[model samples]
Target: MKSLKLMALATLFSTGLHAQDRVKGFVYHDVNNNGRRDGKETGISKVAVSNGVQVTLTDEKGWYELPVGKDNGIFVIKPRGYKVPLNRDNLPKFYYLHKPQGSPATLEFKGVKPTGPLPESVDFALLPQQETDDYTALIFGDPQPYTARELEFFEKGIIREVAGIKGVAFGLSLGDLVGNDLNLHQPYIKAVKKIGLPWYNLIGNHDMNFDVKTDSLSDETYEANFGPANYAFNYGKVHYIILDDVLYPNPRSGKGYLGGFRKDQLDFVENDLKFVDKDKLVVLAFHIPLEHRNGDTFRSEDRQRLFDLLKDFPNTLSLSAHMHTQSQIFYGTAEGWRQEQPHHEYNAGTTSGDWYSGQLNEQGVPAATMRDGTPKGYAFIHFKGSQYVIDYKVAGKDKSYQIEVFHPKVVGHGKNTRAGIYANFFMGHQTNLVECRIDDGKWQKMTPVSAADPAYLAELHPWDTSEELLAGRRPTNATDSPHLWRTAIATDLPIGTHSIEVRAKDRYGRIHTQKSTYRIEKAKEL
Candidate 1:
């Protein structure tokens, strides 16, 4: 009888410990705009809440319970037609960090402070908004500024242009927010806040704690600024999943980092998707591109795991940034994708183009054009229902400027000139159709070829051939651009000025037209 009583007591103790580990919360409509859930306020049902892994919905009374650890962030997955509260800086305050012991003291940057104990109730307040299916999101990739001067360049060159810009629902930066300094995170936030939209950030390899011994502790500084590195939410018909795929102290070398996900992160994605509808469009945003020209930068197993989790969802898109250059990468059956439609990963162009390199423009800002000949630009992702389209916007230029047309200044009439016309469509893909027209003539098809951009070559030549010292830094050597197209133009026309127009039908079926001038002059007498 004594031994049986001891066993029962032990079981009760274990059960009590489990009960303490669970967190209960309420999702209520803050009608008055105050955070508290007043007695007059009603509860919002079916709202999703998560502890960075498992997701649960609120009950009829807006009550929810989820398991959490000592170091966990309890956040609400902001539902469509409802918005979360924003802090003074317009940063969304949707999460509550529960770190009893707080971050490790050895880190150079500050992290979250210790919360003595769990609150009696962790409640999330949300306000209602009329959301339309068709909306635009400003997407920026790698505004990575290494120094204060570069940060100023970002503020003047990029932020100043988009200040007070309207119509964008929100903005997302695809990692590499700053170069190695974690202290600049706040400054970066202060600068980007002028855009007047809730900005979401992704953790990159550069934005990590290098002193940590394990991969899981790599994002202490990031987590301190931004609640959780891995989280998801819904807006309109799209579900957005932001992940921290940078694995520090790479298992192979134990020195540098690797691009991959941890098992817990994979589990979190799998668990989160269980609550999502398969028909909804799933957009995964991360830092490092899954594959490069050489090969896959991330681990195969981790990618396969994510693929397995996403197999049921037919409509999916991934966004990444790490490579200084930009291109479109498709992964089909050969790459272990199970769906008939290949997975499209858009490697977005950087805002801090080529790390703020190249000669200064009239505005005294670095030209900073990317090595691929694509201008430093940001992308606008327009979504309607489950469908989406991307539009690349060149900074300090008109919206209609999509392609750069490069050709010889003058060609001899009735003489076979070796010069050819090239078009560098900013967001062109293999499926895009590029055509050129000269002097109001019929459109002729331009062949897509992997070659160095003639325009970028011209930009680089002046720096190398200049006798005197240049005013600003010189751009890096050009690489073969995937979106470049070439076609030999006929010089056998009448001697006069001719207008050459280049039109491109992009993968989304949208047509873009650009025009340039070329002179057809008579042959020079030798």
Candidate 2:
């Protein structure tokens, strides 16, 4: 056969151009123009295809090459929108192992036993998405931790729960793979690889370092850690687009820290989907929530055009993190999303539930429950043909029913306020304020709210009982740990400008100050 490049050039021109021979193959959108890989049929074009060190874009035919090595290699780069299957260890589906007959080998995964036999082909299939079927996609907000110990709070439990539990075609985590410290990316990647399923990443607000200067500061560090931060892969009959939606406007001096996709990547998405079936479903995953950040005043202007573009797809389920709590939302011309209800619109839950804060359960697991009733856990999704279905399995105890929290809007600014003291808004509004005294002013004892409200247990799951859903908040302990939000009181100092100092004692014996501002507005204003 003539070289792929010669063939490509011959088919289109009079001059001969050599094919960049590495491994010539392609990934295409299986547009259901009915059972055939036709010439005129479109392919997933211009997506990134890499061979570990080098990266390139697939030509118009969705065809690509990266100097294939018969040994120690296979095809893999972010497949654009689709998700990749992670092994029980959580490593990606794209990797090559070159072992010389019975030589002691160093494994990429710490515990991945010798895979034994390598497969003949490592190809991924992408379905042209027209619309989603009877399915939904589960979304996680964030699981940012400043330290390694925190990753344990995630792996010891939630990581264990997700193994082989493959009902959904794929899964995703909102950004903040590590805190601002980029070094954690490797360990975090190695840790989550345990689930052993196809997964993708979303860029988030917390995923960047505000210290760097320039938009091009290159998340190359992030890229090396998580494989081209913005790439794609395929899963159960759908074209899932995983984007490095976070643009670090400046890393050196710190400038464009706002979260959104770049013009080039967005252009790639539009071009990549050229072969996608317009009527099929589209699964978009990134770190920053596409919706307004918790309380932003206007819709992101950048997303408006993207949203308009998304309308072309019959069904689209966009998942994001950043809020560090569980939230759900729907866009498009859908009725449920168009209407305003806390339940139908918001961010997804975080992986750590609350930065791995609070006391351990009877099982010695960190109590990771979101204020919205969901606890620290990963979402499960089932994708068949062109549809997706989502279900959340919270970490901690094995739950068969959805949790439900009943409480009125928080009242009064004092930690003693009824709702403020008992409400587990650790996932919504962080209300950890200190209560101080004026005399020789001894900071007295107070009721500190636990991120995982031990008492915040849902009296009943959403199925057994009903309640309004609210937006999610992130896990605290960003710098350290939020410890425990002990006990407190109002000090009853005639509602006006008053101040107080607060402290909390944790189950781990760690103590922290709850010193922050508090306004004693009329309770009726709640």
Candidate 3:
């Protein structure tokens, strides 16, 4: 009888511990913006809340309960027609970090301080806002500033142009907000706040705490500054899923990091999407591109699992940025896309192109052209209902300047030469049609070629051949440009300067045109 009583007591203790692991929260409206559930304030019904993996919706009373682990973040997904409050740095405050033991002391950077016990009620407050299906969002890829000086360049070269601008809803940086230095996170936040918009951020490989051994602990510093590394929010008619897809300490090699998602993140996505309307547009934002030229950079199984989870959604787009170069990739049935229309992934250009390398410009900033011949720039995504159109805005230039043409200033008249006219359409794709004409001559189709951009080569040549060292660091070596078009120049033209016009039809059926001049000099007597 004594042993039976001891066994029953032990079982009772284990059950009580399990009950303590669950947490409850309320999603309420803060009418006075004081961030408290006042007596008059009412709870919002049907609000979705998550505990990193599992998702649950609030009842009619705006109360929700979910099981929480030792290290997890509880967040409320901001639904449409409502807005989350922003902190002093303009970062959305929608998550509560729960770390019972805090971060390990071996970490190089600081992480979240320990929270002794779960709160009696962990509530989230949201304010009302007017949102519509038609809206615009500013997207920036990799504004990675390694040092204080480079951060200055970012502030002057990128932020100064769009500060306090009108007509945009909000903005987000893909990742690598600061280069390896965790200390620069504050400076980057201060600089980006100048834009006067609520900003969201992703945790890149560089943003991790490399001193940690496991991937789960790598984002300690990032989480300390930003909110949950994986979370979702609704804007207008679009559902944005921000993810930290970088797997640190490489699961395979146990040394470096790789591009992939963890099992818990995938579970969260799968559970979160269950409540989303199928007609809504789904946008996934992360740091590294799913498709890499160097071969199999992302884990194949993880991608397949993600695809399976997203198969039912017909309209979906993904954005990534670690490459610095810009390109549009399509994943068809061969790549496990289940929909008829292939999935589109935009590998956006970096604000810090080629790691802020190249010669100094008139503005005292590095030209910083990308290796794929794309200029350092940002993208504006305009969404109408379920459709979105992205426009790339090159810094220090007018918005209309979309194409860069390169050709010899003068060519021999009536003498066949190997010189070719090359046009680098910044947003061109393989399926897009590009044509060129000279002096109102017949329009000829330009062949798309995977080759180096001659214009970028011209920028890089001076650094190599100059007797004295250039002012700024040398640009990275050229790579094959995916959006470049070329056609042989006709040397049989008249002996005068001729105007050449190049027109490109983008994937969205929008036409962009640019013009240049080339002179045909009469061949001298031999």
Candidate 4:
């Protein structure tokens, strides 16, 4: 009888039906926030938990069971009104990584160390917090500090200004936290900790283990630092899904990485959304922009699959930050969007702006102006119930400074010169109205043009033209600015200093104005 029982147990284990094949855990309310469940602490029912791909809910007793793979991260989908404990760096401690075999030993930067065996029960604790429908979140793109010096630059240039900033719920970095050097991850964390918010991060192409052979292992180091490459959380009425869309060792050319999603990730997304209410606004964030560049920078089939999965959700938004330039891309029927209203993807500007290039400023930080003329800055997304409006805050500048007007310092009087006045509306879309007038004159509509920002060109010109080497690295060449507006300057104005006012009405029905002065001079005899 004992031999027969052993054989049956072996068969069940092989088929993944035995009790040993599954892991049990409890999602409980930690009344004391001690990071563990005690006798008095009780489990929370109906909370969603996942083992990477499959999602399961806790029972009435708050106990849950999930089939575990050899390597998987079991995490609780952070629900609204509940807060997770944070580490010293303010990174949320929500998930438990179960890698019994651990990461490969050959990896250069090091990954998760070997975790010998699974515990009898893994418990996660949550604390309650008050969250309102109207709140603000700080969003940063590509604080890609390549060296320790550059990291300090980020600290003084960006973080120093917003440190201890109030009225913000949390902060998120869209990725490339460090350049290609994974060793700098800890320093980057230390630098950002000054902001004093529960910081969240996404894995960018630069934050990968390039030495790995397969894409599955590319995020070993990243996972060690930031828990999971893909996870979901909730704040008020918004459901945010953060993903690792970078596919290293491009499957086609076997070279650099590309932007796409794996089958398992898509499956996780599909399963995760089942628990989300259709009325809630879903926000997806990743490192690379889904919008194509050059020839299909991102995989089309994968994008279509994602779109199909999101077809049921009426309210959705996606955020990306790879190009270093800021632009708004809309996906309509042509891009396989299933809804009547097109989807919007905001390719945000980077905080590291042009890789920390250009001459040093008064603060001894790099000018780091973006290639599109959008200043190096961060964004504040104000959320109310499911809607949001984004405002860009330029570093070391007042919030009211939104438009950069480019015009000659002086122009010949009554000359029909081609000297045009250009306004680089950092947050303006092509559909937004941009008007310009001279000294309280009639407001004339400025035509939108897909051309380079002359202001950025002027900044770039000195490096090449200067006889001696400049103080800092040269900024990259300017690309055609998508949010630029142009109008001919009325040189016929009275011959004195005249204030040129440019007002831009943004997509959210907010108007921003900036003024520049130029003198109309009399013609000099040649």
Provide TM-scores for the models: 0.93, 0.55, 0.96, 0.96
Clashes of each: 0, 71, 0, 0
| Per-residue lDDT of model 1, residues 1-526, tens digit only | 9999887556334322223488898999999998888989988999889887678899998999987767788899999899999887777889988888888888888877877689989999999998888999999999998888999999998999998989999999999999989899989999999999988889888888888998878888898887789888889999999999888898768888888888778877987898889888999999998773343368888888888888999999999988777888889988878899999898999898888888887657898888889888799999998889988888889989999999999988888867899999989986689999998899999999898888988888889999988876789899999999989988888888889999999888889999998888888868
- Given candidate 2, what's the lDDT at residue 488? 40
lDDT of 2 by residue, 305-413 (tens): 5665565566667776666555445454432233232212335667777566545666465665554445667666566665554555566545443322222232354
Candidate 1 lDDT at 270 equals 87
| Model 1 TM | 0.93
- What residue runs in model 4 are displaced by over 4 Å at the alpha carbon? 1-20
Clashing pairs in 3: none
TM-score for candidate 3: 0.96
Per-residue CA lDDT of model 4 for 126-166, tens digit only, reads 89999999999999999999999999899999999999999
| Deviating ranges (above 4 Å) for candidate 1 | 1-20, 292-296
The lDDT of each candidate is 0.87, 0.50, 0.90, 0.90
lDDT of 3 at 185: 92
Cα deviation at 98, candidate 3, in Å, is: 0.7
Kindly report which residue stretches of model 3 are placed more than 4 angstroms away from their true locations once superposed.
1-20, 292-295
